[model samples]
Target chain A: MMDFISYTCLIVGVIFWFWGTIPLLSERSVLFKLHSLSVSDTLGSMSIIFGLLLKIPREWPLLVLAIVCLVLWNTMLGYVLAYCSSSGEKRENR
Target chain B: MVGHLIFRLTIWFLLTANLSWLNILIGLSISLLLPRGYTNPETLKEWLSILGKILWAIPLAYIEAFDLILRPHNDEDMVCEQVEKKRSHRLVFLDILLITFTPKTIVVKYHEEGWYEVHRVTRRKKP
Candidate 1:
């Protein structure tokens, strides 16, 4: 049961990774692509790390830390990227 | 104050993933020896609440992701939102993080006069 669940999580995470990245090819605005990308990427990475944690409980501390870093840094990075891109566009227009 | 120290120490322990006496001593020293930033005026209760909200956002984000995936042609809008009064930098950071972590919304800019320029993907209206 545990193995099944772990593999499921890993697979789902990969699906999310693809789902998020495919939109980058679309002609949507940068912010729109960014919104979807950050959300799914963060979720996918966390899910993958969680599956690993369940598979190797001995390395849980590190795995848990990875999840935390993924959530915090990914969110922050998303905000920073959005801010920079929008502001730079404004500067170009000026 | 104490919260900052504890936060840093927790990260150190997690990074090292060790519980030896020497490791603990090193972690403590490193956490303290680091240059401290200006004290955050926010109370512990508020901080914990914000953290809880962030944790809550995880599951919410997944739901939003599925919605975005299912409906790829959602309308997009950019609008300025008012920021809460007297928010500290840390709180503002958390606010932006929480907002952008969701799939449908991203904060494009934080204006100096307490406004956030947010870009949102909303569902299309039926004709």
Candidate 2:
């Protein structure tokens, strides 16, 4: 049902947000954490959006497109942020 | 070989708007994109993780920051109490916060009850 879908997506989002907080959850590498979060943001958001789409009436194509765009945008942001943080180290080394 | 075919097949199934195969495909893609190599910030995974930690830590760190002169520790929190009438940058909490991000001018105000708060901030510093 709609309730099941929504809950599943939301629970996953919460898990993604809380994932890095655990000590030694992944490696200590900040880059790894960012990588994990990128997955979290993209797929987590996708899950939530997809769940919402199911609740709506018709317009399947539009909803799917919207979800795709959201995923793409979030992925891009993650990429840029990841690069910026690592580039800092390069600058420091120079 | 097998992985590539599976990945492509998953994508084909996904195009049909099938949710069943979506999660599986996304999980695999994430794993593939993750950087693998020497334990350095040379890969995409390492880079993303760093940004993640910084973004994650910011709110918690800003909340914990104090607004006064405080004791210094190894390198986490940058605080230094004047000892033996000699001063040293003992890596106070704030200092660590400052260096952790970009450099900045931080303003601290002192209160009567051994307390302080971050009042202001400014520019980049040598990392």
- Candidate 2 chain B worst ten-residue window by lDDT: B67-76
Candidate 1 residues lying further than 4 Å off, grouped into runs, are B125-127
Candidate topping DockQ: 1
Give the lowest summed-lDDT range of ten residues in model 1 chain A: A32-41
Q: Please provide, for model 1 over B1-127, each residue's C-alpha lDDT reduced to its tens digit, 9 standing for 90 to 100.
A: 7877888988988898999999999998988899977855998788899989987998998888777777774678888899667878888888988898887888888887899999998887546
For residues A56-90, could you state the per-residue lDDT of candidate 1 as single tens digits?
89988788888888888898888889889888988
How would the docking of model 2 be graded?
Answer: incorrect
